[model samples]
Target chain A: MELVVFSLLNGVLYGLLLFMLSSGLTLIFSMMGVLNFAHASLFMLGAYLAYQIGRYTGFWPGLVLAPLIVGLLGAAIERWGLRTVHRFGHVAELLFTFGLALLIEEVVQLIWGRAPVPYTVPSSLDFAAFTLFGTTYPAYKVFMVLISIGMFGLLGLVLTKTRIGLIIQAALTHPDMVAALGHNVPRVFMLVFGVGSALAGLAGVIGGFALVTSPTMARTLGPIVFVVIVVGGLGSLTGAFVASLLIGIVQTFAVAIDFSLIDLLARFGVTVTRADTFYDLWRIKLAQLAPVLPYFMLVLMLIMRPRGLMGTRET
Target chain B: MPIIRRALLGVALTLAALPAAAQDSIKIGYIDPLSGAFANVGELGVHHFQFAMDRINAKGGVLGKKLELVPLDSKANPQDTQIALKKVIDDGIRFVLQGNGSNVAHAIVDTLSKHNEREPAKAVLFLNYAAVDPALTNDKCSFWHFRFDADADMKMEALTNYMAKQQGIKKVYLINQDYSFGKAVAAAAQAMMKQKRADVQIVGDELHPLGKVQDFSPYVAKIKASGADSVITGNWGNDLSLLVKAAKDAGLNVDWYTYYAGGLSTPAAIGQAGKDRVKQITEWHSNVEAAALDEELDAYKKKYNEDFYFLRTRNLMEMLVKAFEQAKSADPVKVGIALEGMKHQTPTGEVYMRADNHQLIQPLFVSTMSAGMKRDVENTGLGFKTDGRIEAKDTETPTTCKMKRPSA
Candidate 1:
């Protein structure tokens, strides 16, 4: 029971963190139709900048300042870099961002070297928030959950309630109609791209504290964000949220349940012979398969629900 | 017409002298991961190899030929290593050094041993600096391959020997990166612990994916719940550092026995998280007071801007030079014969390659990190203090290798 509770809680926290990064990509992909391959690079930049800022001014200020710097830089990237590449079509824009991701990784390594930086949780939030069934949970984890929920709420309010948010939504469904009605579609596209990047930056600031702050943080988190966005349907924010939690919970639960395929097959009266050449394949437990579970969900979602769980339009 | 003919003759003579100029130096291939997740450790090792050669070159050329190190990036992949090996062989280099991943080492050893069998005249010697897979020196051992670092079982034997004497440590947890090397460590530790201290309970055993985990908090949570008093792991690089950091943040104050505690950037990366609790089993630590290698150590550290990490790398170069001097030839076959049973002196102690397995038996140290360290890497303001030293003779384990030597 304790295992179930802890795994679910941690899984939700992890899913929320994924949502924090995936939400921006969802908006940008849905509104702008650009995949933003370097989105995770911006996430890495935020982590590295936060690590640098936290080294001087402390974590609280780093929390505020790092994302702002990344957000502004992101806006500049949309304004100057992506806008310039927009003329070359989506394929070209994706290639540019991919190249940019490699360059950003090199730059990070050049500055920080190829090892993990000591970007630890601050002493104030370093202690456990509370003990659960004799297990201590760090306060920083709760802080991550709070910040992710807060961002989701703010994003929800901005997309659904505000005037520009209404325009972005209208553009999502009826870009031609909105453009025909004289809305500056390019401006809306840039806004979505910039705002989406800021969210990823925010995710990085919190996630770095949760993980190791290193040049490859972006690479580590890059594929999972895509899995979340894709499994949620490319453009559906709510679907991304649902997929995030679903995938997160499923993966977390998979890790906790240590059932081997051979052991499982044995219960059904199928014995695994030691002489089998491929015996090692059957030896893998669910815990070892946890990392690949998200991708399995990805493949299943693409085949079964191409439009995603709650997706309005086909992706 | 006579003047033009004389100019052509001069050009031909100059071109003829080029191969001789190259012949005045022996080119050794140092192949390892240079651009991947393991690049930091690989690059550190390359720097050590280059520095070791510089020291050898200063003392006059070995066999009157300057030892030149040719570095090639293997990208930490076996296929890439094979391609790199072929390229080096094609270039007439008969010796290669690599030591980050045992997978890469296996690829090199297999490729080179096959090459040596197929073409005895062009046989290449694969000198290992730090891949500690027991199979390399045991069942899967190759005649053309020589390991300069102690195998995993030897290090674990030394480690568990020290572990047996400790007062506490009722319950122990075994955690490692899920791979061949990591699995070997866990299997070896479990067997040795059972042999040494049957009463100690192995409360938890887990293997996480290698280099893929972003958060070790859940894993650390599991460790805390296991009621473990001591944790043993073979994790290195960022994986090891993150594990230590997570344990510290969660206030799990268990003693950690690790394989890569003093690896590149790890000790510093752990910082205050592992000041006194983290311990490592290694051939040499930077804090060891070795007066003999002081001058070389000072100059080497100054050039690299980081403390020397791999003592086996230094031993490799020093032994290679001695082999050349004794054999009086730069031929790979002759050098290989000389290196098989070579006894070389490192600053810590004298070590010899066991003739049966080609495993270097060197003095091993069990050390821990703390402040006011006499020596530190990355200015971490920390140093490793030795807890125990296992002499070279004490670390010998019987090998299962039945080497297939080339028939003369």
Candidate 2:
């Protein structure tokens, strides 16, 4: 029971992290209609930036400043870089972002070298948050959960209760109609893109220390963010939230479970040996299945639901 | 009539000069992961090759002509590697240097072997510096390929033998990434255990999918519950770090021994927390002592501004240079022949390419991490102090590779 609870908590934290990055990606896709293949690279940039800033001035200041820098960079990218490529079409924009991703990775390596940077949790949050049935959870994890929830709440408030929020919602449903209504749709698009990118950057700042900041993080997390956005339904924020949480819980639960098909067979009085390759075939461990669970879920959802759990269209 | 004759002579000279220039320059192609997770390692290799070329050219170029390294990014994907390999071949490269993944190496070998089988005279010679799959040197051996690093079987034999001698390690848990390298390591370790000590029980054997694992709690929990005295893994990079961290978090008391520990086993990966939980067997550790190793490593660190992993690029560069010197010609055939049964001193110690398998025979180090150990005077992370050294004498007996080499 304690294991289940702990797993759920872990899932929630993981889900929030997925949301932090995926939310930005979804928003960018909705506003700009460009996938921004380098969204994860921007996150990686945020982490590296945070690491750099943290080296100069403590972790807290670095955390706040790094995301702002990333936000400004994102603004420039949308205003100048993406706009230049936008005229060429979405495919060209995607290719441009892909090239940008590669360039960013090389730049990161040039600055930080190839080694994994040792980004540690702040000393204040270094200790165990609390012990649960003899297992201690670290304080940094709790901090991550709290920060993610706080951000989600803030974003929810902004999107629901503001004039810009109404504009974004209208833009989501009818981009052309919203633009024709005399609003600066391009400026709104740019703002959303920047804000979304900043969220990814924020996630990176926390994740770099939470995990390890390395050049490989972009490659590792890039696909998952895409998966979350796709599985959550392309343009729905609510759908994204549901999908992110679902993926998180599903993956966490999968890793926590240990029963194999062979164990089930053993209960039915069947025994298997190492010489039997088929015996091991069904003996797949849950932990090994964690990574592919999201994709599997995505495939299933695509086939079964067509529209995501909270999606409006049959996409 | 005189003007026409002079024009014809000038055209003839220009054509003649082009062929001579092409013949003078030897193009050696290299395929490795230059853009993905392994890019840094691959970049290091490229840098080392360039460094060697610069040194070689400074001392009068090879065969009185310059040697050019044509590099193709494999992107660490097998399909990408195939494309890169084909591009290199199509570009008219006669010799190739391949990087260290078993599946990718096997693919390149198979492709080259088929080419050699069809046309033996124009066969491309392959020198593999990193792929350590034992089958590549054994049953799946190719005539065109040579491995510079010890195979998985060789390393496993040494590891299991050492484990058998240890008194406290009665039970073992084998956790490896689910791939060819992992399978080979597990098989070799299992075979060695059967031969050396039948009493040793393998409590748990698990395989995690490569590059997919984010959480390692389930594996760690199993390891703890299995009551294994020692754990052996063939995990590298982030997987290695995550596993070690998870195990520490679970407070598992088993001694962990990992092959391919890479940067994770280094001082930078573990910080102060990892000093107690992990011990690694690697080709190079800064703490391990050999003659002039300190000077060489210090020089490299000063040049690069970071610690090197395996010094794999340096090792490959040294071997290539030694082969060039021994052959006394840049001709692929001559260098291939000369590289067979050649010995050279390296930073690790004296290494020789066995005439049989063309695998490098060198000393391997088994270093243990300890708290308060320092790599340099500046104290980089919790350092890895050398607890034991697996000397050249301790290595497995040499086996003759019966595979025949295709004529170039």
Candidate 3:
């Protein structure tokens, strides 16, 4: 019972963090038809920038400024870099972003010197929020969950109720029609890309302290973000949301299970010894394979349902 | 006519002395992760080696020649280490130093063993400073390879000995990174604890993906639910730091017995939360009460702006110089023979290279994190306080090495 409750809470928390990153990638992909491969690298930049700013102005100010700086940088990249590469086709754009990711990683290493920066949770939110079944959930985590939910609601309200959001949505499906209706379609693309990158930057500010702030941070979390988007559907924000939560919860709960193929086979009277071929494979517990489970699901999803859980269109 | 003759003789003498001056320095090839994810650790190892060499060179040099370090980037990969070894051999360096990962060490040992057998005259000796897998000294031991740091099993033997004496440690949980070294640590912890404190219950044993788990709350929640009094983990780097941070954030107040709680950025990451609760067993720490060594350590920090963590490098260099002096030769074969079963004295205690397996038998100290000490790591203001010290002989476990010696 304790495992179930905590796993759900932790899973939701992890899912929200993933959603924070995937939401921007989903927005940019839907709008530009170009997958921003440097999205995670932007997230990493936000964390490093926050750490640098936090060293001077404290966490609260750094949180506000870091994402703003990253968003502006992203906007500049869209205006100067991506706009220039637009005529070169999708592959060129992809290669450009891929090269940008490597550049960002190297530059980060150059500045931070390849060690995990000591970016920690603020002392204000470092206390326990509540105690359930003898385990005290931290206030920082609760803050993170609240922040994620608030962002999700704000994003939803913007996309549905606001004028600019409507224009952005229109630009996603019919940029020519939106342009014909006297809207600056190119400017709208820049705005969406900027906002998307800002969302990733925002995620990094909270996520960095929650995990670690290192040079390899982007590389480690990069593939998983793609997994979330792919499983959620290529160009679906709602799909990304559901997929993020599903992957998060599923991965969390998997860690609680110690069952292996060997354990399951023993119940059916099939004993496997150490000398048996692939004994190592049989003995590996679900918990040990939890990190790889998302990728495994990605492969399965590609095979079974390419459109993803709630994806409106096929990739 | 006499002036011209004298000038020609002077030119001949100058030409004759050039090669002797060129041979005045002995180069030792350093292969480790000088790039990639573990570059910091690899660089740190190089810093320690260079510092050791610099100090030795200051003291009239080793075997009448200054020790030169040739650092080659291994990237902490086995294949890259093999390439680095080949490059070192090609450069005519006879001594190789590396110690970040056991997998890389295994590759170096295997490749060097083949290279040494095929090219006996150009055989290179491997001096390991930190890679501490027990298999290196046991079943897979090599005569050419000498490890300065204590192996995982030996450290566990010392750690469990200290834990067994504590009455509060009843229900222990074991969490480690899922890899060969982690498995070895877990196995050693379990076996040693069972032998020492049979009544202590192992409430949980878990192995998570190494360096991959960003969140450790689920694992901590499990520990909290299990009502464990303490945790034994073989996790290092971010894995160890994140686990400790998560445990603190979740308000899980269990004692941590870790292998690397004091490594690199971990002290800063855990901060004051691990005060008096987290314990680590190592060959040496900063605040080991050796006055002379402490001054030397401070000098090292002043020079490099980094903590002197790898004390084994000091022992390795000192002992190697001793062997070189004793052998009266620069030949690796002679040095290898002289190093076997050789004893050396340091400020900490006496240590010896066990001839059966080229493993250094050194005293291991188990220390706890404390705040406001004379010396601190990573400038965190929190430092390690000695909890218990297991003598060199007491930490010794019988090895299974069947070493093949070269013909005398």
Q: Best candidate, DockQ-wise?
A: 3
Residue B396's lDDT within candidate 3 is: 88
* Candidate 2 lDDT, B1-408, residue by residue in tens: 999999999998988977664576677788888876787667766765665666567677676777778888888778888898788777778789876577789889888888767766666888887888777777777667878766777777777767788877889999888877887778778878878988899987777788776556556655655678899888887778777766655456677787765453234554554665577776676766655666655665677665545555566666766677788866566777888778777776777777777677777777666756546311444556665667765774556457777544
Alpha carbon lDDT of each predicted model: 0.84, 0.75, 0.88
Cα RMSD (angstroms) for every candidate in the order listed = 2.7, 4.3, 2.3
Question: Weakest 10 consecutive residues, lDDT, candidate 3 chain B?
Answer: B14-23
Q: What's each prediction's TM-score?
A: 0.93, 0.85, 0.96
Order the numbered candidates by TM-score, best leading.
3, 1, 2
Task: DockQ winner between 1 and 3, please give it.
Answer: 3
Cα lDDT tens digits for candidate 1, B198-313? 99999877888887765565677678778899999999988898898878766787999998888677876787788889999999988887977777778877898778778888
Displacement of the residue B261 alpha carbon in candidate 3, Å:
1.4
Q: Which one wins on lDDT?
A: 3
Encode model 1's per-residue lDDT on A23-92: one tens digit a residue: 7788788777788888898888888888899989988898888888887887788888998998999889
Measured with C-alpha atoms, the lDDT of residue B20 in candidate 2 is 68
Error (Å) of candidate 2 at residue A51 is 1.4
DockQ, candidate no. 2: 0.38
Give residue A173's lDDT in candidate 1 (0 to 100). 74
Candidate 1 residue pairs that clash: none
lDDT of 3 by residue, B234-273 (tens): 8999898888888888889999999888776778777777
Proportion of true contacts reproduced by candidate 1:
0.41
